[model samples]
Target: MKLPYAEIEFDDTGERVHPGQVKDAASVISREKATDVIVICHGWNNTAAQARDLYTRVVESMHMVQGEVPGAASRRMVVIGVLWPSIQWADDVDSGAGAGVADEQETLQDMIRARIDDASVADRLVELVPRLEASSTAQEQFVALLRKTLPASTEGEDEAAFEMLATGDVGEVLSAAKGGTDAPDALAAAGGAAGIDPMGVAPLDDGGGAGFFDSIMGAGRNLLNLTTYYTMKERAGAVGRNGVAKALEALHDAAPDARLHLVGHSFGGRAVTAAALATSAKVSSLSLLQAAYSHFGMADDWDGTGKDGAFEKVPSRIDGPIIVTFTRNDKAVGVAYPIASRLARQIGAGLGDQQDPYGGIGRNGALKTAASLPAGTLLDVGGAYAFEAGRVSSLNGDAFISGHSDITGRQVAYAVLTAVATGRS
Candidate 1:
């Protein structure tokens, strides 16, 4: 079907858009004289087809909103859907594995072993196994081994390298090994008083020397999960900052006067925010639906200026409202996000406190940071509601929204369209 706005598809890497295609897309938007360009970013675990389906639904629902809201239909609109490699294989390790694997624990260990072997850390793993078995606290020993074996500096390496280790740089080195070259600095900056350990595992009972292997295996599994979680987080941020950010800049340059509205779900939230933060173009509205990014990402300042959240200065770039939707029903963000953040040592250490240093925007909205704006509005969107301009609005998306992937709902589309239509004036 012919879309109202020119449809542009980005690859998983978010880097390899054909020059001709880009020119064609720019021409389409420029020739259409679109006053408003809406960019949608999909979250994790979505294929290109799924992302397209979601974009279609959202655009259709926006049309419905236009039909209802006066003057909305008269506005010329352009839609851009961003598709990236947000899905991590480790996320589905437990569920995607075949039923034949009776032991999930063994499967997790095998996955970790494979990752280590793939990274040429098999010899290191072998060496650590004995240390892990010998140590009274297997978990601590395993963590130390990971810190010791992984490379400290990953300046230009394409793959994981264990060439050298730096003193007193365990977390940073391990972060770089798990994620990429940029991870060490990013992770180090994020480090502070550990909040809660979301995936905090208890040490197995010391069975003298008999249960040593079992203990090591458990610690291995936990370590693997933590490493994978952090890697995914860093990857998402990297894609947004590097690849997606460039694309958005190109789009902005093509249609400088166009009113920009961004919609991002799950990790796509991180992507869009990164794009906004990086771009000098003014954003009309930013809508985050079950955003998996830190709740304080858009804060003005956090923790006495030691380190800023991902989107700390985003408010200055946005000309209109910052809309955030959160629901307790989203298990992925509510449960998994915090745990992952804690495991990565991004937040203060326990399950989570009421303040929720590790909580996601999808679970808790902006929290303390929501008050940063004078006109900041927080509401429960159990029914139809209207949002004002130049404000940061947090909506309770319980009634209409189901969960993380529930971005295509009529209510959500209406909220987005309303935010755009209102901000245009």
Candidate 2:
């Protein structure tokens, strides 16, 4: 099917794979005389087909529910989808040997070799994978190599990432990666519960022979998952700040009078937020769906040490309301963020929930922003929203958002359309 939207592709280094594609998209928006442009970005672990499907479904949903908002159905808006080189977080470890013995090892090896910048570190890490569960020395070596492989943390929230990597006990690293068992309901919602399970790895302990994550290989898989989490985080930031930001500017240059609305899911959320901060164009609104960023990511002073979030200036740059959809049902961010929190030494129950210092924006909502961000529910289709310009609204999506990828529903589309319309004069 011929998609309704144009696409901008980016490489791993944040360079445009096809620069003319962006320029062409810009020309179309200008030629079409669009009044508003909505740029949607997909998060990590998506294939090219998956990314296209995401854009297709989301745009379809928006079109299906545009009438819910006043003037939305008649709005002159153009859609642009972003495609970056984002890999799966735990594809290697998720299937384990059950996926295939030689194939599993080869896949893990290929992933490690591709992601880790240092050849020596990647080789050593891959060699140690086989012994991670049985040998303490192998586990220790794996952790040390990973510590060396990852770039040094520069943010206040990431201060403990290296510390977690530097641990001598592989079990502690695994436990940290496990992110504790504080919220059983979230796990159930993830597919272990009574409803949808988008993550597919939610029910780790279903009492079925120690489950997959409890096995010896599963222990090793935990460390691999942690490594990819950090790797993808860095890659997403690069693609957004350097690639998407430039695209937004190009779109603005081509159509200076058009209003720009940014929408991103998971790591794409981090990317678009970074783009908003870097671009000179005036952004009308931002819709972050289950964003895989820190809850403290936009705070001016989350630590009280005078340090701010990585994207602390984002809210100031957005001209309209910053709409964030979050829920405890998202196991992707729920599991990963708590590992980061545990690295920061914020252990115990509720590690990835709203109160944790290192909780994810997707798992909770916009937290510790400079302004007092209001909290509300992610209303149903045709529901009313009292969104104010230049403020942040955290929408509780536990009722509607069943998983991380549940952003393409009519209800979510309505909320996004409402956000775009709120920016209209």
Candidate 3:
């Protein structure tokens, strides 16, 4: 994700990557042109180093799998890291004005603004990018930019910047600045669908399920959904699951074979599922990690085994499969059932440990809606964060990877990719 050496801009204080900066990164990603684009949305309260570590771990595994190693094939996934300035609140940090969190953020922002102040610094940054794979480099630059701009950006400002980047405007700006807008601009110009509202705040009940996010994780669930909606609309402006539906007619014309692969953690898994269904079956695969499929109603009803009325209509939409990953020890699911109970007012169903009649849960403890997926189709993961732990959340509670936030766990990434690529029941 590193921008072209000539495309990056810098200043005396720091180098700031506005919307235009992402085009270079996107070009790098699109150049890889993998069948499955593993879109990663980091959990809340993650440090720059933490995000890097997590990203590398998965990427390395992907590379290994590509080499016929025990890991997943990175080539199969076009890595897209959604870098938003949404603060992942760690309970350990004080939230008051002048706390260490605020101070550190301010410091980070200063470092960036300062780095961009030097003359030729922007030009020199061009060295950071080459005509090659750069997801890691781009992310580091993005992290640096985040640190530098955190102070200047509000929640909305940060989100707007991310929207710009995701929708291809950032790359357009950068490509135009570089005096060459062929690749970046062309990619940016690719039209797509838009309009997808995030699942607003709702109470979460820790009902001791197998695949939902626990209450302890930070607010990553809603943050992802909100950002996702805005990005989709900005990118395509057509064809979404709900709220907004503006399809990217140009996408159909540009990358005819290209399809979307969505992997959601915890409740975000639920969001991914709903979002995917909204598409015209253009999605290749869906991986739900410990997600809570709340469309059926509330917590009490989850264990009741009642039929998921509206949800039942989803599986038939896309030709792809659905994979749900969860674990018996995960406390995240414990939180989801109660939440479903309170809201839907119906008794929840089972923890999905044994079997959810729906379909698609891997032996790794994931729930699957499709036993076998299309050749290019991905799995739809549901329940809580089945394989991992508390990592991301929203205003109500934590969700992404219901069990734990350490997506870098030994077999977690393996299990996820294996289930998706293989589509084993």
Query: Could you tell me every candidate's TM-score relative to the true structure?
Result: 0.68, 0.84, 0.42
Q: What lDDT tens digits, residue by residue, belong to model 3 across residues 65-128?
A: 3434222343345554433222232111111222233343343233223333233533333333
Sort the predicted structures by lDDT, highest score first.
2, 1, 3
Distance from true location, Cα of 80 in model 3, Å: 1.2
Assess each prediction's global lDDT (C-alpha) against the native.
0.57, 0.73, 0.32
Question: What ranges in model 3 sit over 4 Å off?
Answer: 1-26, 42-53, 68-76, 83-253, 292-311, 339-402, 423-425
Report the number of the highest-lDDT candidate: 2
Listed per candidate, the RMSD to the true structure in angstroms reads 8.3, 5.4, 18.8
Clashes of 2: 1
Clashing pairs in 1: 194-348, 194-349, 195-347, 195-348, 195-349, 196-348, 196-349, 196-350
Superposed by TM-score, candidate 3 places the C-alpha of residue 330 at a distance from the truth, in angstroms, of 2.1
**Count of backbone collisions in candidate 1:** 8
TM-score of 1: 0.68
Give candidate 2's error at residue 325 in angstroms.
Answer: 0.7
Question: Per-residue lDDT tens digits of candidate 1, residues 1-425?
Answer: 23455544555445645545555656777888888888788776546787788788878877766666544667888787776655433322222222222354445455556544235554455445544435545434456655543333322111122222223344443332222222444332332212112322211122232121123343354455444434445555666677666766777898788787888887788778877887666788888888876676766555564555556677667777778888765656643443343234443333322354656677668755643443223233233445655566787777767666777766787677767877556
